[model samples]
Target: MDFEKIVSDHKCRSCIISVERYQDGGFGNIRVVAANKAHREDSERVFNHPFVPDSPYTDSLPQDKNFEDFMYRCACLGQPLHTYVHVEHMGLWVNMFLLPLESDKENIGYCLYSCDISPYADSEQQASLSAETATHVLEISIKLQGAKKDDIRQVFRDIIEDIRKICGAEHCCILYHDITNRKYINFCEAMNPQSPLQPDAIYNNEKFYDIANSFDSAIRGSSCLIIKDEHDLAWLESVDPDLYSLLLENGVKSGILFPLKHNDQILGYLWALNYNVEETVKIKETLELSTFLIASEIANYQLMKQLEILSSIDILTGCKNRNCMNNYVDDVISGKAELPEPYAVVFADLNGLKRVNDEKGHSVGDSILRTAAAILSQVFYDCDVYRAGGDEFMLIIKDGDVDETSIKSKIGQLKEKSAIDTDVNFAAGYYIANKGEDIRTAMRLADEKMYIDKKEYYAKHPELKYR
Candidate 1:
């Protein structure tokens, strides 16, 4: 029977090695005579050549002196041998079985069968690994949960470092979603000491979004994506050269992208770059639990921020509420906050809100309030606009020259526009405060001037007064 034919016919990863004895009583070159389909593919990827008749074994394969000695002895003595081998460069652990091929009384060569066994191990080994992985996950969860609100970013950095180490990745990062801007922002990152990328780098430009969209499209409806190398993205490269070039320029040779999701929303993306195959597989298997915990922490952080905003934002006018204004005033009075020079205070009061509320209903009054807030925001886009009272709005502009005449002209235009659109009227006055003057004094002056303007408006339109 032909041993090479027999090895080729096997379903597993098997290769027949022809071992020749030299005239000097030493082993000669080892050559592969035949290999099965699985072994051929593995050889092509790992060694850059498939096993064929008279093909010399490549020197790039990881060398294990003990494994080579065992094969030599098995061929010389015509005995079978078995052992486990670790290929460090490839990050693979495999089981090997070597059997001598003999004809009559002479040993011809050795037939080798190799099977990847990295994912499986003895019961004790499996239990120990599981225990260690569980400990890591628990420790990370505890650290994130107990972290202070101000220290959450640091906690994320620590988590990224841990993930990078666990996955043996060259870099790891979290990309946050900027919903208002429709962009993805790099929130934080961890990188290997030798990596080219920097930590905490922000990516919000058009090129970054193009790359993100390509990855998002490729992994649509999938929980995670794993690209082995550039060849894996042939379609993407063909369809979008800019995106492909961007990724390559950023040193993304191979990586995985995991979306952080809550309910139906994608909160962000978790990225691991240039990890080895074994580590990538391990990460894919174990990351689901850890990512869930991370997503929960992110969601909790977002909720806290939203609560802070809601406490200070006026719902009807979409401006800072009285609570926020009072806090600012207290801060200024207590010397905790310093006002910038050349500041101005603008006071505005709706002219006929009570009449509209009494006759046209509170809904109409609310609409007018919202419209007034919008106009104030548009005119003083660079200043802080606040709803100081039920019918009063205030604006504070700092570090800019006060053009009172121009502001009054804009207000006049707004009055004409509102009068035609909704019969709404508003009166406004501004006071430019001198340096080292009390902010309260400026506010009082602004209010008195606003009252005078209101009186003039009522005198001009007495028929529009409240019933």
Candidate 2:
């Protein structure tokens, strides 16, 4: 067969690949037998070397098991395959096609591989999925689009379960990575009830990130890792023995992993364990399409959460802002949130904030406010602290868990500590509201008592002027 003529006829970058077959049903040495002019020219332009014939495919392209597996299936099994993939290392989208070529020799199988490269992904090419795969991907997108802000977490869990069932896997997990912290930020995993896997106990953010980080190099910079058989495991073992052992110990016989990426940033990883090995190709195809939508949705969800935190939290004092306190009060009044039978509302006013701001700069005053918040947080461990306004904080403490005596002692300790540390002083007071009592009443009484206590603070420091 004139392999050169066959590849040369193709318009795009095309090549003839030969796989060395063993008598015992194994394969080795995937070599590029011939390349079209376009392929050779492109190779020369990018790699700064001429594409030589009868060279290892890795010499021309990346050593990707997924690519090798596709070639093997096309050449040896006579199954033509087509896939549109994002080549992560090169930051390019490649539309690839594999067609089995007629081979006269049994020991050597041939496949014609052709690809059109693009800097950006083509939406039409991406949408060219099998009907079943298209349906699955479409359903996920619809669910994500319909989900409300409050429903996002549960919606994500439901999606994970759906993906797990679709892959016929024992478990499916989506683990988000915080690259700056080297931590597993968020995780959503679906598992069979009987599966002997840790639900949330075993792995922490730091401990599991090591194994996750190793997958990039273990796959030799491939976008995803598909460990279908012992051959793939052997490759992993050779590259990372410890990780290989860890997977084996965790009953990971076969798995597929795809990174949840957004705008070239790896948001996290989507992986399945003990999946149906026979459906590996279909699973990969479905997930490749599905992950695109999932990653985008997760990224938007994370962004919204960060915005919500910024809106509800006080930046200076690291406590809930007045807006958050108002919402909580509304929730309690509207019966959206139920408080216990007896509760207390406490007001903590920083006594010397104005004096500090006038004497020193506003930055020093800001530090004093933070110090006051820290002391309040330390004392009111089981309560919510809100920065109601400048130099004023509010706490809603449940009374049954902490009695009045304990609260008074803690307040006394705060006063003594603030006096010793010249940074700040506290004028704190609380009012307990029993069943059938209004929270507004407790808040008003707490505020009045706090004002009364402020006079005592002034008396304690007669030499210093009080505003």
Candidate 3:
């Protein structure tokens, strides 16, 4: 199937469905226009499926392109798709698909005619129901839309509980794919009241590991399967007897595995077990939902991860910035349970940043700062290095025995070496923390010493400009 095209079409239909939801929690009827036979069939199947009561397409079919355009506009304006549907009883008005019951997936098509129940039914009553449905649909959309992994699991758990209440299939389990671990991990499991398999302890069983590995291989290969009859369950049982026993004890007779893939690369799988429907068809429905949810979630995850990385990184040099370095400083200074000797803080100020930036350009100045950071990191051990600001750097060297004289010798050598290859030069001074000294005082002392050393160096070499 041309899944991209399918997704595009569904996105369009979904926009319309959202507008319908806002019109009155789908109490009024809605219609969807399909791009092809497959799209229409898929929409209808999703709408009619008994287990998916919240699907947006249960009752509506699109009549015209104008209505489709209208729905898209509403969605753009922030109308959630699951909260309302548009419908006209007299003329061809836009209609949205809706599932009626919170637990039932079947669509009950209702238009203004059906909603216009008895004239005697007060306007107040109609308004109340409309408001209630709108609120419910909004809540459902918020819960399902852009959900995280935890959110997805919670929604599935709620769905399973609802299913158990309606279908008498008290025992259920969901296996969601953990992409990083390359395995299908159980998210939630609902067990029969009389079963010996304790719900809390079932996840700890070794059989879950075997099942996860088996599903991981299949998911990696981009395949989904349904364990329909006793034979399939028995086959899995033979691989891990404990899991089989647990399922059998809990009255689990069927299961469905749905692969989640992006661009033919399987990212994960979702396995639903012990539902009322035949294992095969339920598996198909699950595959559809899994595809939608996984695609949306992976996109969201990638975006969030990128944003997080960017937030912590320095945009210029692509390194850990001041914010991250501060945390590192705090971690080291606030020693472990047992306090040891205080560490040393090295304060460095680049001598020619303004000159480099003014004469050579800011790019060269930035390069010099980056080079200084690299040199300091290479030279120090167990230290916190920071680009304190433009052309200024700081280092927190832990538990070092170096005195003022030795540190000065090291800095002098680094400066002489740097002048040979690069125009970078910096004056550095370090102060070891005393018993009662704080960070600020230590830094102040270091800065003062650095300036003194810089002054003396210029005094001896009268030709060099000190400032």
Candidate 4:
């Protein structure tokens, strides 16, 4: 590697690390910082490496803090360390305060400090890269504050643009996993962004499960993997040349995939591609730390998605509940959830439900209510079903031409199957709106019609025996 080019471009000192087995089963690295103006090596001078303890540096430590004192003292006494040393242990990196002493400064009891420890983890000469990354993230987040959902996405795009400017990488993808859909949805802020993987807009449940399984296996085995590579690209080229060309044309080179995990489960994976960059694609400590924070953010977004789904779904019947109904209507009124030209609202009331509760036990009544809900849900085809109230259900059908024959057949089947001695009849009224009309008015009309139908039924069957 040409060290000078890296130094010039990134404006930071570079180091090559040689890893050996760690003492406590963790990884350890020996960093040999690039030769700069600061420390011209003298063959006669002796200096202790950062990793070693009990060097001359440990001597100045307070008696109360044994381990840290010993470690620093070791560095001071054993070697001529021109810069501060950092050690990562137990999930924290601690930087020791050290300075290079000049020949005149040593006699004068003073030394010159070279770099800022607060900006970077260790050293004065190397730039504090992670602090810079954090500042960029914070600035972007502040700009996105109080923005709408769409605007927030735009902010993310802007952030990625900044990243591209700094890192000179191509093809970054932010995938939002919909646990409800059991899929990974590609979220892009750019309007009309062409999907590279078309025909498969999202990776479904089975595919997500496969990725999750692979992730778990790798975690257990402590093995790293690159899911997509040149071979995969070649295969895609063989099968779908246009898609392959599209991917290549878009400057998608090598990609780094890290699973976004929450509550110990992988929600999704974030992918960043190298494109034309020649930097080593290896995961660094700083990048790993950033990934942890990113994973948390992604997890939070996924959690909100789940909460949104839960808000819409009825916990009891697995249908759109009252809250969902309200949201649906709001969406329809606001033109968010678009409806067909001719929409129909069917209001249904289960007859003799209160009588059943009065005669039979509440358990039986509960069972009857559940059965009625199930029947209504099963009878309605491609309609939004809601258990609006006790013994009252609502169906919002997008297709206005709901087959009356099919609904009658379903009611007949329920009447035959119901074991309750009382007549298992239900009063239902549907109001179709040909032109765009208020959903509330349609619902009210259907409800009034249902009551009228019930009244007529009771009036005609006055002589029939009551349950």
Winning model by lDDT: 2
Clashing pairs in 2: none
Which run of 10 residues does model 3 get worst, by summed lDDT? 110-119
lDDT of 1 by residue, 353-403 (tens): 898899889998898888888877876777789999898988887844566
Going through the candidates in the order shown, the clash numbers are 0, 0, 20, 22
lDDT of predicted model 1: 0.71
lDDT per model vs. reference: 0.71, 0.85, 0.50, 0.49
Task: Assess the local accuracy of residue 65 in candidate 4 as a C-alpha lDDT between 0 and 100.
Answer: 18
lDDT of 4 by residue, 1-467 (tens): 43333223422221211222233322222222232222212101223233222222222111111122122222222222232222221222333332322222111121221222232343333234446555655554555454465465665576555544444444455566566766556654222144253222223433443453344333221112232446545644664454455446655555444555565566565555553333222233223334445566556565676798898877666667788788788998898988775767888787776777787777887777677777776677567788786777898877635555655565565455553535356777777776667898889998998888777767887853332
Q: Which ten-residue region of model 4 has the weakest summed lDDT?
A: 105-114
Could you tell me the TM-score of candidate 1? 0.62
Expressed as tens digits, the lDDT of each residue in 1-467 for candidate 3 is 23233335443233113233333222233443223334445445645533222334434342432233234333333322221121222222222332221212233322110111121324333233344333443443455574675466677566545434333344555555566765556655565576443444545655665655565443222234445556557555665565567667655676555555555455544445554543232224234433445445555655576787687667765556777766655654685222244656777777756767887898887787777777766666456567676666777655555566656676766676567645666677878775767666777888887777667766776764544
Better of 1 and 3 by lDDT: 1
lDDT of 4 at 253: 50
Instruction: Tell me each candidate's TM-score.
Output: 0.62, 0.93, 0.43, 0.58
Better of 2 and 4 by lDDT: 2
